[model samples]
Every structure is written in C-alpha cells, then in structure tokens.
Target: MTGNESRVAIVTGGSRGIGRAVAERLAADGQSVVIVYAGNEAEAGKAVAAIEAAGGNAAAVRADVADETAVRAAFDLAEQRYGGVDVVVNAAGVMPLAPIAELDLDELDRVHRTNIRGTFVVDQQAARRIRPGGAIINFSTSVTRLNLPTYAAYAASKAAVEAISPILAKELRGRDITVNAVAPGPTATALFLDGKDEATVERMSKMNPMERLGRPEDIAEVVSSLAGPARWINGQTIYVNGGAA
Candidate 1:
C-alpha cells in the first residue's frame, strides 16, 4: 500500500460474480480499477457505475482474457490510464461440467483455453509490466481438491493453474512481486447455481464448514488482502472455500 492512490488494477471478468466484487473492493481500497468483461457490456458498465457511486475510480473494458490480443490491449489500457499497472486478478474462467466419458471434447477444450491459457496470458503480461511490489492473483476452484463428480474437466483446468502459479512466483523473485491463486468453494453465483435444484444446492452448501454457499464478496476479501498491504503472501493457493476442501 505504499504506492500512489491512483495505482491501477486490471480484473478480468469484472462484470459479475467474484470478479465484480473484487473490482469494487479494489476500487474502494483506492486503486483505479479496469473492469474487463468478455460479452456483457451492460454488466461491465454497471460495475463501473457502482464503483464511481461509491467514490472509487473504475472503467469497463471489453476483452476476452483467453484472447492474447485482447488481453494485451486491456493491459495497455490500464497502463495508459494510470501510468502503470500494479495488480492483476485473473478471474475470468468457465465451468462446464460432465463425466469424463460423457464430456464433450469441445467443451473441455474451451475450458482449458479460457482457464489455463487465459491465466498464462495474463500472468505473462503482469510479469513483464506490473510495477515492483505489485500482485498477480489468479483464480482456481475448490473442486480441484474436492474431486467432485462431473467436475473432471473443469478441475483439470484449474489444477494446471495451481501448478503454474508457484513457479511464476519463483521466477519473479528479484521483482518483489507476489503471484498467488485463490480457490473458492461452491459460491452462490448465477453460474454456480444454474441448473441446480434447491435440494442439490442446499446439500452442496452443507458440505462446507460454514454450512452455506459463499458470497462473491467473501472471495473478494481474499483478493483485496493479497493485492494490498499483505505482500508477504506469495506463490500460495489460498482456499477461501469455507473449509469445503
């Protein structure tokens, strides 16, 4: 937190869910936030407005993190707007569930491209451009550890991310930057609840020690802490999953 008040942060998939919450929280903590969304201009705009109304600085940028060119441009936008980028939260991802034998190869490929490749693209940019003392926070899911049925493909994608992050941290050793991942449990986001029955949802919630679904804000708090004064936390996959794993 020793940086200028105008420090810039780029949050992918910032239009909704945990990404939106992270963007708003970072803005509230005095960073100029760049909200990156894939296909929802309106949701992104609303996120910006919410930050602005809360007396925090933010702007919405349209980009698919899985696309290298788009992600490069998003980083460029942040640097141009605030002089330098200080933090990057790779919250953009997809979760399509199916048993191994029943899983569509197309669906598996899509998840891998977005979750695994997208994380690499963003981390590469952050490594090269982010200021010293900056943070690179990636997203993973608790399902990696939970080993839930129908989560094989999705979990595999995140498991790749979990494996890569620590190496990135070591690679950036001299830079004083921290690279980490946050693995959230079953959260009550639109994506997580979609197609699930009430009984199923409640049962999933009960799996956690907290005995309830996670809120987007709950995950945001972890991101905010890592991105700010808590610089000592590096190369760790912090599970903010209510001990569900």
Candidate 2:
C-alpha cells in the first residue's frame, strides 16, 4: 500500500542481465524501483537512467545480497524514497560450475552464501516490510531439474531456494502477499554465454522445446505477472524454461 503512490520494488542484482530486465519491466509497469547491485554501479546507474528515460521512477543502491545490514539499508532507501515496498525480486545469484568431487569448497561457499543465504536475507526483509497484497519473487534455476553436468553445487543451492519459496508463502498467510520462485532454463545472458562456445550454446538452446535460448525480456514478463496482477498465483515455482526441465 502506498498508503497511495505507485508501489515500490527492490530488485536485487538489478545492474545486469536478467536482473536488469526485471528492474526495467517493473518500472515500466508504473512502480518506483530500487535497483540493488552488488557491483557494477555504472550498470546500475544506467538501469536507473533507462527507467527514468521511460518515465519511471528508479534509484540504484549497492548492497551485497548476503549482508543483512546492507540489504536492510537498501530497503530503508526504498521506504524513504518511495514510501513503502510492495515487491522484492531476489535475483542476485552466483554460478561457478564444477562437479561435486572437484568443486572448490570456497567457491561452493560463495555460491551458497549469495544464493541460499542471500535469498533468505532478502526474503526476511520483504516478509517483514512488504505492504499487504505484495509479492516476493525469488530466482532459482532449471538446472535443478535438468541435472546438467558441472552445475552440481549451483543446482544444490538453488534447490534450497526452491524448497523455501512456498514455505514463506504459507508463513505470510493472511498477509495477502504472494511468494514464489521463477526457475529459468538456459538463457542468453552474459553469465550463461560467457564461457561456452557457440556450439555449446546451440546445444543448450535446443534443449528447450522452443529451440531457442530464453530472452531476458521473456523472463521479465514472467516477473511482471508475479510482481503486478498475478495475486492468485502464489507459492509455486513457475518454471520459465520452455519445458527443457
């Protein structure tokens, strides 16, 4: 509740890729946005500028998703600037590919810290502060179902994320707030395409029934539905992977 203004949204990792798309789409939908990024402040600023250019209100804040205090400050900024938050998209995540046997413990910890712990931190803040009728969207990955090689630890962490989404929805019962996870399949983001060769990308793309990599906008559209006008669709993980999983 604005008590009457446009609802505010906090999109973590909003500086680039899918997160950037989510921020833009939500702002375009008429909500004031806080684009939270762990780094790449320049990209974050650009995301804010893009929203402003589109006649939407947005601000960028820097915060490590796993850091509770910094996340709280980001929420504080949203409240101060836009009145109160009504949506939170926890899209901040890290993926370092390795099989379980050879996986670096440090890398696993980092991924888990940002993926599992980060979701928990952001959800905690949203659960505490979001106005009634709000939505909390967390990002998981289709790899959990795909069982792809070299994604063991990454999948494991996101599996934890998937496991918690519905639990939080129940916890927020009677609050009229919805909690859900969006598990995207292989998408054409820098994070996904950076290391692979074109053939590899092609193979992954064809894995989907659609026979193409999911576009950032495609995923953003799903987020828009959840963040804005999809109140009845709560506590479920809507896999946006084109049935690859």
Candidate 3:
C-alpha cells in the first residue's frame, strides 16, 4: 500500500465491542491497526488474529488508557510496529450507572479514571506524537444529551470528553490533525446491555426514531469516515445514535 493509503491506527479498548468493530473496520479500510486493551490479552490476541485472517495488518498492545507511561508504550508499539500513528481512536472507557442521590463515589472514581482521565492521557499523547493529517477520535455517549436517570456519572465523564475534543482540535491548528468525539446512543454492546433487562433494553430501543439499538459497526463507520476522508469534520462531536437525542 502507498504511504498515504496505508495509514496506521491505535484503537484503545479494541478487544471488544465498538472498539473491536472500529479496529476491524480500519484494517479493512487498509490501515495497519494496533489494538490496545486495558487487559484481556487473549481477547486482544484474538482481535489481531481476526485482522490477520482477513488479510489486514494488525497487532495488539496492552495499556491502561489512563496511565501515561503505559499509553506511551502503546503508542511506541504502534510507531515501532506500523511505522507511525495516523489515527488514534480513544475508545477505552467505563460506564457504571448510578443516580446522583445513590451515587457510588468509588465507582465514579473508577469510571472517571478510565473514561475522563483516560481520554486526557491518550489525547495528550496523540497531540504530541501523531503525524500531521492524523485523526484523534474520542468516544462519548448520547447519554450526555439524553440525560438518562442512571447514567449521571457516565454522562458527566463524557461531557469532559466532549469539552476536550474541540479544545484539542483548535490547539492543533496548523498540523492538519483532527480531534473529534463520537457520541453513541444505546448501542447493542455487552457494555451497554450488561445490566439492563429485556424490558429496559426494549424501552431504550424505542427512544430513537429508528426504533432499534445501534450496532457496533454503525459507530465504526463514523470512525472510519473521520479517520480517512472526512477531513472537513474537525473538532466535532458527532451523535451517531439514529436520532436518539
């Protein structure tokens, strides 16, 4: 592949869910992928194997997205293995539901450590090291807009993500790097459906005009577009939730 066509990417939390889909999509789009996971080395290996089986270039790296040193090593692996980083999708995050009245501070801390601090750590690296024309995509939630009752802490963390995306984009003025965030609604990922009952899930499905839960591939499509040809879409928080909010 030509240099421009063979862009390389690092997808955090890429061992599962929307991140897994994003890794596969980017590889299918001709980018060499480095799938970054917080843990789950086996799953990370599986993701790499799937990409290789599909005749795409890929590797797996383990790093806590909130840990600066680990994140640096992950980026180092991407640069060392795939030549350089062209796209960084900060898809690593946590979502623990709780109302403000019954909030669990420890869980909130854990969520923020992974979701909010993680974005900051990862994006700081992307800002410092990503090549010109690179794209940095952070994951957000439609819950921020939907204002769902039990997602207070999760949405608050993502609100910080939304705040950082545009600010970083503006900071990268002449570098041609685009920093953006993708806010997804009730996507059919284990992370989203884990605690919900069938009735609750169905109710959420009805919130959007589409009357269905979003698929991981749906969100992957948006990431792919932003990472590749969607140059004009800089510093934007795109809601890919099918009119959920």
**Candidate 2 per-residue lDDT over residues 117-142, each given as its tens digit:** 99999999999999998999999999
- Give the alpha-carbon lDDT of every model: 0.92, 0.94, 0.94
For model 1, residues 1-245, the per-residue Cα lDDT tens digits are 35345778999989999999999999989999999899999999999999999999898888878788888899888888877899999999999988999999999999989999999998988988999879999999999899999999989999999998999999998999999999999998987998889999999999987899999999999999999888889999999889888
lDDT of the structure predicted as candidate 1: 0.92
Instruction: State the lDDT of candidate 3 residue by residue for 65-183, as single tens digits.
Output: 99999999999998888788999999998888878999889999999899999999999999999998899999999999899898999999999999999999999999999989999
Quote the lDDT for 116 in model 2: 97
In candidate 2, stretches whose alpha carbon ends up further than 4 angstroms from where it belongs are 2-4
Write down the TM-score for model 1.
0.97
Quote each prediction's TM-score. Answer: 0.97, 0.98, 0.98
Model 2: lDDT equals 0.94
Worst 10 residues of 3 by lDDT: 1-10
Residue-level lDDT for 204 in candidate 1: 98
Name the regions of candidate 1 deviating beyond 4 angstroms: 1-3
TM-score (C-alpha, index-matched) for candidate 3: 0.98
